[model samples]
Target: MCSTVVTPTDRVQPDVALPFGGWSAIVRDMSEEQSTSEPTRAFREARDFLLAHREDYETAYRDFDWPRFDRFNWACDWFDALAVEQPGVAALTIVEEDGEVNSLTYAEMAERSRQVAGWLTGAGLQPGDRVLIVLGNTIPLWEVMLACIRAGAVMIPATTLLTDADLADRITRGGVRAVVTSSSEAPRYEGIADHCIRVGIGGPVDGWLDYEDSRGYDGPVPEVDTAAHDSLLLYFTSGTTSQPKLVEHTQVSYPVGHLSTMYWIGLQPGDVHLNVSSPGWAKHSWSNVFAPWNAGATVFLCNYTRFDAEKMLQVLATYGVTTFCAPPTVWRMLIQADLSAVEIQIRECISAGEPLNPEVIEQVRNAWDVTIRDGYGQTETTAQIGNPPGQPVKLGSMGRPLPGYSIALVDPTTDEVGDDGEICIELAPPPVPLMRGYRDAKELTEESMRGGFYHTGDVASRDEEGYITYVGRSDDVFKASDYRISPFELESVLIEHPAVAEAAVVPSPDPVRLAVPKAYVVLAAGREPSRELAGEILQFCRDHLAPYKRIRRIEFAELPKTISGKIRRVELRADEAAKVDGGERTEHSYDEADFKQA
Candidate 1:
């Protein structure tokens, strides 16, 4: 299922990865503007190094350095540079469900964003103002992003799916000063941020300025002279807890940090890159906005209210998509459809949001002749580990530490380095990609970056050859019958069953054994829930899994997920805990002992 995307014959040996700084460097004795360009140079040098070594991981990882910047504005320096270099090249293209297409070339995008910046500035937007954006993959979203950067305003990306209450919390937490949304979504902001300036797209609304007005503002908006440490975006992480955490990204952090993301994705200039991600989440910025564009590739989008794998494949082929990124959920849905039916010219495929099942990767490689590489990242930083292009990828491993990242697996009990432990990023010099910290939560921030490392709070196992296979979340990994269990491992096996489409494994309380593994499964299309089906699955699990690891209980239900589509195992585990304490029988649950072993 795994194969190298490039050969040694493709490029010569000058391919070194981004190794700009292990010690943070700030250019001295230079003008403020000149100093800004110095880090930009350092950033570009590092970027070009990764591009040169896109297929040569061994040399890249060993030699890569982190670029340091004191002042960096990506929208002005980097994006505008690309626009000037490749004016007529496609930068953004979106296909609507009705077959209508909208596009902007690099030059056109730059011009439009400049116009938007001018309009927003004229309408009372000031430097450091937080603008909450709630929109789909439309033209204005891109325009506002660049516009915010030009004005030195911090952008807070919110999904169209947010309710009025969600908007209130974000406005209060993020300190809203303005709001940009579609005419349809403008109503959601009423009384949320009442004094906040409202710019609505599509059509005019009462007490709201139309985005169409920006078309008339013809003058260019000058760039804001911003420091690298200035906050550019505030992301509210999708959390399983009651309230989400606000993650702050600096002007350089995402814009410059995504050089690592660009390297991991193996993006090349002029390639049409499509990443399936919601706008509000960090992954959207990781792949959709920053990564592909960081590589000077086209950011492609297909707007849809519902997912249709066949229709999506059609769009992919029609647009000649060269690079594709989708979540594990989308990949699972694609495998259910007839993938061979659609002929795509996709050269690179990546899965994020969760670890992709090996079975899903095998299915895709069989049909497309290209492997679906998996990557590991978090909202706190850019891509840390990934199977880069042309590298020999291990089936379950998410490759090694990216060019700028220094990964360590530290044992929880002893705080010693080990092969299997919590994934932590070396922070002695601090990677540029790391977030400034948790916004307004200094205690939590210090706690996370404590002990000379930025703890990822995720666990994994590193093999002898340097491949890291994902275990489960630190919280989700539990002990069953005194043996540690990884939910990801069990869920990976469950999905291999013919009847199962998606699965989440959690520790179920058991009086005799202390705890046992239980699975909550969603059946494949045309498969109905019944004791017959559950028994069949139990038998399958019993046959394939170890005795202690076998599924002791099964429940047929839709998995609980965050709005960003990540399955929430903590919720399921909580349910199991309540059942054990209350002595309540779980509804629609089937016990493996009901169908005794042969």
Candidate 2:
């Protein structure tokens, strides 16, 4: 067993011997130091309350309260405390496609992160300094995050897939003072900034500090007087409609606020949780770091160059993943495979990133004997709505308001509370999970926080039972022949067809009806696009949808998506409008008018 000795002052004592065979940290008996910090006690009580009533949604929702913290550092007070209490427990496990598995226990991670924190301070990454971290789902990614938290440095996570131009934009706009990236990606910053600090992972690079050197630092971690409201993270939103907005989160916002997310995922201590999301996105931290770790669960990651359904199933069984969360895209793909072929132990399954179709959820439930719950949230906040464990899930609804959040559906035009309108979060007390504001954009922030609520820009309709079913984005919902239409409703139906792999519905400009619903589809494996196939698809829609909502045009093509894997329907809408203005038709588009009645 390994342990950390924390004093009443929250400082580590002299190094103690550990059986795990890594760097020695100030080891202590957690039972003796359980009440060392008030913040720790408060945080634990709130967490324990949720865990005690995970399935009892009524009690959890009614009695749960956000922990009040005037001064709190989650890494020091919570994660470190967990490390001392459950030092031998695996905190993170990363399995590679090549069959290599790397595991880090709680005690090891604490010490390693401290070493990294020391190295960072020594290297001039001081408190409040912004560091751009560009790496994949590797061990250092988690290490750096913890170290940054401990060091009180603001972090801006960047995807490895970012181009040179993207890096320049982030470095310029984010005010990045330092960059830690793989050596291979170092060359991309040649002309960006020569004076900025460069720390390379993987191996040594010219003029770049080697990250491997951090392991040698056994010095005490630098003291960080981080205020509870100090900015801790800056996330660049995926630009679906316009320029990416820089979202700012404080120390308490993401770290303490993720308690709601922990409850939504139904995470339990010692549970193995697997979430499929790339490193740069907010969802990555939502599950991979804060949510699971907040519940004292192991964060499991299966890394592959490309997604393989069968291989993923095997990994799930191999690691004994108790909780699994993936995007709607992954769930749809999983249904295409022989899901029953693998015997797994996934107890709680969840779908997020986008509203999951009922068809995908039904297939997974039939095969796995566990319902795939759907959740809703954005980069601006933690889970605001979800079908948590023990709740009777509605077919298309994203469930009820999560604990700590007060949801309101308001008419966008009149700003009146209604059953069907834009989803909004009440700001009466202002939930802890909500973002501080958009960085460097004062006007936009004010606009979002207007009318005593944070406008989510997405539309939804709440049933009498309080379950909210997502409609399209406020801008995505259009009118065809003076009738309101939702693209998601039609796209969900389109994807149910066996030949369709992915479908995006957008308003196709027409002089006759003013506008009509058009579907841009991607064919499934072994299926080819043709006139006959297009007609069949249109017929399928005609049979399922009402007369006004029928798809008037069908085109088989790849849908454009942002770097974060969200579909950019704005592009398709613009393309269709331009085509009508130029009096031209897309070469591959097939109109329903061409297909005559029998």
Candidate 3:
């Protein structure tokens, strides 16, 4: 058993007497040292600049300078330097579904990555070569990731859930020169490319290189010289509207951008951080890879094929998770379970990916005595706006901008700064954390970066306190009879109904009103998808919402979502529009027709 003690509020400090055997120990000591060391002039200067105009958007927007570095390798400069003395520190703790657990110390992970790097280099993988990595939440995933980073090679991380078509598109579009995947997935890449080398994990395959043999290679790993601006990752965005666009990140972009994420999570050295996210997506990297590790906290992972709120709660209590982050969907599911029976040691709870409904936040706070803080960002950047520690968290607002980010709300039509409009980053030259650009789409990239801002393509409203409240996406919010209807707003209210497990609201075309609100709802586990339940939800909407915003039509169906688990509102809207075009019209909706009498 671990001897480190933790308070309800304060983080666990480094255990000096504990055996320094893993990645966790190395990170903890490093974080502890950095926290006490006098802040560098550069760090102080950058921090002061951010504090000076924490809420003064106009001034910060004009005055702030993004920190620049001509030579910086995060692994070598920060991680490896810190790992030298703390060889036994635990770096990663992974709990499998069947209760089996695996851990790696910082020193062990570093050496393993070095060996993998040596093996990869010996196999003719060169710096800047793109390698497609598709694997689950496993040790080899992290080993190969660090190896790729050390090798100065770009990686395209793909989720194993992707289909053959998805893999084909990524291989072609990403210009993948190699692939490192499980032996189970070797068949997917059979005919793709002859030049692409396949490094299979978990036993040898007939045509693929064995990952276990990589451990035996006696070759010394060469340090590849890498610049901050070199491409490091190419992420294909989960397509909610159109085809997935390849988002390019530089060596410094994510490595540095995650500073914002670290601050947002309020992670500290020796803290055990658990983030609920799948492999391959940006959020996974945000919490699982960069944020916790950046802060020298233990990356605690609980892997399950299906989400089990009870099982997760047990892990949090058993593993002593100090900080926890999850999307709203998971939080909503947890709310349905009896949280009172679960013991959680979490110091802070955070929500991301989508705007967390205020009801869910309040419910968790009531039960767990911890606020579920909301945060906002995209695949293109790290946590931009979030409710940080020691800050007042408004009920529904995603809090103020972080240290390195400068957020602006510009009116879409006027292109002038405003209290309510499209969110943008007003950088003279874009910040280091911002993606290099959408890969190979010069026209799209140019258009997005125009108007002196990196347009987020999402809408929001900023109040006097600088807390930004998310509105629907630019395309998701539609005008019904000249009144702007935010689907997210209505959906938030809709999900509060007992029958609704999930909900997506969109505009349904109407001749008289131009458009009307329609809801596609997924029923809760025990609830049947019937007209009676639909009528109850529709009535619930009418009781809570304004007449104009009340859901006029409801369809019992599963909400369409991107593979990343974000609801595809664009697809929902397109389907509604098609229904209208097909002349499938509702004569009387819930409000117009008296359902109470029936």
Q: In terms of lDDT, which candidate is strongest?
A: 2
Model 3: residue 24 alpha-carbon error in angstroms: 16
Evaluate all candidate structures by whole-model CA lDDT and list the values in order.
0.84, 0.86, 0.78
Give candidate 2's TM-score.
0.95
Ranked by lDDT from best down, the candidates are 2, 1, 3
Best by TM-score: 2
lDDT of 1 by residue, 1-598 (tens): 1111221121111211111220012112224565335655676678778888999998888898877767677877777766655655677888899987777776677767777888999999998999999988897898899889988999999888887888899999999999998898776777776889998899999999999888778554657989989999999987676588899999988988888899889998777899999888889888889998787888889999899999999988887888999998899998898899988889999999889988899999999999998899999999999999998878888889998889999998889998989999999789988999999999889999989999998999999988999998899999987899998888888999989999999998888888889999998888999988899898888788888788888999999887667898989999889987998875678887777662
Candidate 2: list runs displaced more than 4 Å: 1-24, 29-35
* Alpha-carbon deviation at 246 in model 1, angstroms: 1.3
lDDT of 2 by residue, 1-598 (tens): 1222222121112233432245333563334454258888888888888888899988988988888888878888888888877776778888989988877877888877878889989888888889999999999999999999999999999788887888899999999998999988888899795768889998999999999888777666864767889999999998865788999999889998898899989988878889999998899999999999998888899999999988998888777888999987788778878899988888899988778888888888999999999999999999999999999999888999998999999998888899989999999999999999999999999999999999999999999899999997889999999999988889889988999878899998887788999999988888998889999999999999999999999888998876556778999999888887998876678998889941
CA lDDT for candidate 2: 0.86
Q: Which residue pairs come into collision in candidate 1? A: 5-390, 18-65, 19-64, 19-65, 20-65, 21-66, 71-228
TM per prediction: 0.92, 0.95, 0.89
lDDT of 3 by residue, 273-312 (tens): 8998888999988999877766666788889989998888
Question: Which 10-residue window in model 2 sums to the lowest lDDT?
Answer: 4-13
